[model samples]
Target: MKFYNRETELEALSKMRDLSFKEHSQMTVLTGRRRIGKTSLILESCKGTDTVYLFVNRGNEAALCKSFAETIVREFDIFVPEETSFARLFTFLMELGERKKYNLIIDEFQEFFYINKVVYSQIQDIWDRYRKKTNVNLIISGSVYTLMNRIFKEYKEPLYGRADSLMKLSPFSTNVIKDILKDYKSDYSNDDLLALYTFTGGVPKYIELFMNQGATDIETMVDFMIRSESPFLSEGNILLIQEFGRKYGNYFSILTAIANGKNTIPEIEEALGDTSVTGHLKRLEEDYELIKKKRPIFAKEGTQTVRYEISDMFLRFWFRYFIKYNDLIESQNLPLLADIIKKDYPTYSGLTLEMYFRQKMMESHEFRNIGSWWEGKKSTEQNEIDIVGIYADDKRALVGEVKRQRKNFKPELFNAKVEAIRKKALFKYEIETKCLTLDDM
Candidate 1:
């Protein structure tokens, strides 16, 4: 469960801190989904430095400020009024920055929207007044994507355009996951790697949970997820209710439909028994970023051949199993639910293996564009390519057929599909075909 990767992010943060020390003041905004290790990264970066870490929770502003003042006093050995307001405490910090340099970290900063929404304006005023004369490296982290975007990216918001650097953290890569597995179970199999990728998708928190429980393989990980008190049972709902709000039922239906293999608009509408989901789909893709609209490689933007996919791997798995069988979970039939997952995991993990190789190719930085290619009017007749990666100059491409087991990959059929795509002449380049399986990871 030790920290892995993030060398680039740590180096960027170090540069930001050095800049704050040279120039009077600088503000950095860190954003990511819940449990992506934002707090860990920030704390690791600020180690061995004078830092005042304030965790913003939902409460009365005066009460929260009292707790923050206590932290400042304990950390810096300076006494401020316990009853002071946040605006006053922040102004005091800015004043202190005039005499010394330090890092100020505010975790879950978007909670201020619930406690006192005016706090953003108060900090804005204080920051503008003292930024030029203070030597404070201010860092704020938020998990609420919509609220953070509004607070920092929307021009009308008080704190808009105030940040000198913005960092969006992503999940660990395939190699990092391998490194983590090697650290714990050096003699791991390809199935272990695929199960980890299928379940955790490189999210550090979930991986750490599985590793802590000694769930190093597929069956144990599935059991750990579907047990009576497992956090995985409710994690997707907990992470998304705030984002989707009251109309979450419709969003959930759409997502579940996609996860269940109804990716096209018409198919989803038919599955939902409702046709008025265009706005919801747009919001899911553009606003919430939970789903994405994908087209075939080399397809036009206006092409009607589009598919919707859940952007998070874990959410896809959750909706596919837990949400799809909520009745089993609600009735306390966790063992039955785990059985269902075990029965269906092979088919489900086949698709996830395709995604794993696509991610691996992307992380290699060897492709200009990467996506799937399909051509047919009907689902039964569609000739689909698992992966297509075009080089920078467009003269070379990697067309891959991915399968869970190498034995399942039929070379003749794969070559026929590649030939069909070549007939289209989508890219007048040399296409290299390969079969990617779990062993490639």
Candidate 2:
């Protein structure tokens, strides 16, 4: 967990910081979901430099401002005796930036909405008036994805288009995770790696917690989760409740349906007692970015060949286990819940293996398009190809079948899937069929 990956983000942040210090004020906005290490990235960018870091906590606005004023004085050696208003303190900092350069990082910036709804407009006004004269490297970050995007990207919002650079931090890549697993457990198996990826999804905070506690395998990971005071138990609820707010019932139901394998619109609709879920699904995909809409490769735009999958590995596992077995958690039946998870981990982790390989192929960057190909209108899912990669050169394609072990891969049958897809989708190219297994980790 020693600050893996994010080299691109660090470079941009450094450039912006240097530009702000040399020229004038430059605003950098960072947005990502909870525990994506926004604060860590910001602080890392400010290493060996003078910085005033402020966290926007939910409370009285004046009290928050007073606390920030003290940090500003202590960090920047300024004479802010007591500024009770954030607007006044912010203006003071901007004015001070005109004389001296420093980094100013504001974490949980979206919390300003809860503290003082008018803070956004106030900052916008001050920023517009002082940006040309100030030399502060202002970095503001928020964990609430929807709110943060709206605050910065919406044309009508007060802080709209104010950022000199906007960066969204994603989870660590498959390579980073592998390096981390090697560091923690050198003898880790493919299943062990998959378990870590399946549960943590390369989220930094989760990786730190599990690896630091020596829970690098499936059983140990689940054991750590079900223990008292474990954040994994209610993490899914805590994460989405803040985003979905009062209208979370339907969203949670839709996500649960997806996690439980009711992947199609019709299936999810049937699971929800035939309630219309188009709007909710749209928001989940486009706004929340929780679930993904998938179609068979080479499928037409309006084709009736769509499926839905939860995009987050951890959330998918959480809904499948934590939400589905909430009765056990609520009743304090931790042992039984852990037992059920152990019983189901193999079947559950296999589906995650498919996703893992897809990501692995994506990370290769050799393919122009990558997806699975399955026949439409096939009620029996017998004719499906696991991984399909259309190379950027347009002369070759990769058709892969994923299995836990290479021994389970039937070459003849996989070749049959290759032929079917060739006649349907990749007839013009040479096909290379591969068996993507855990060893590929």
In the range 1-441, model 2's lDDT, one tens digit per residue, is: 688888999999999999999999999999988988888989999999989999998999888988898888788676885777899889988998988899989999999888787999999999999999989999999999999988999999999989999899899999999899999999989899999999989899999999999998999999999996899998998799989999999999999999999999999999999999999999999998998888898888788889999998889989998999899988999999999999998888888999998888788899899998898755354589888999999999998888888888888887787888889889999999888888887
lDDT of each: 0.90, 0.90
Clashes of 2: 0
TM-score of every model versus the real structure: 0.98, 0.98
Record all residue pairs in model 2 with backbone atoms less than 3 Å apart, i.e. clashing.
none
- Quote the lDDT for 149 in model 2: 88
Report the C-alpha lDDT of model 1 over 1-441, residue by residue, as the tens digit: 677789999999999899888897999999999989999999899999999999999888888998998899999998776664788889989999999899999999999999889999999999999999989999999999989999999999999999999999999999999999888899999899999999988999999999999999999999999988999999999899988889899999999999999999888999989667899999999888899977888989988988888989999999999999999999999899989899998999999998999898899898999998887434342488889999887799899988877998888888888888888845488988888887787
Candidate 1 TM-score versus the reference? 0.98
Q: Show pairs that collide, candidate 1.
A: none
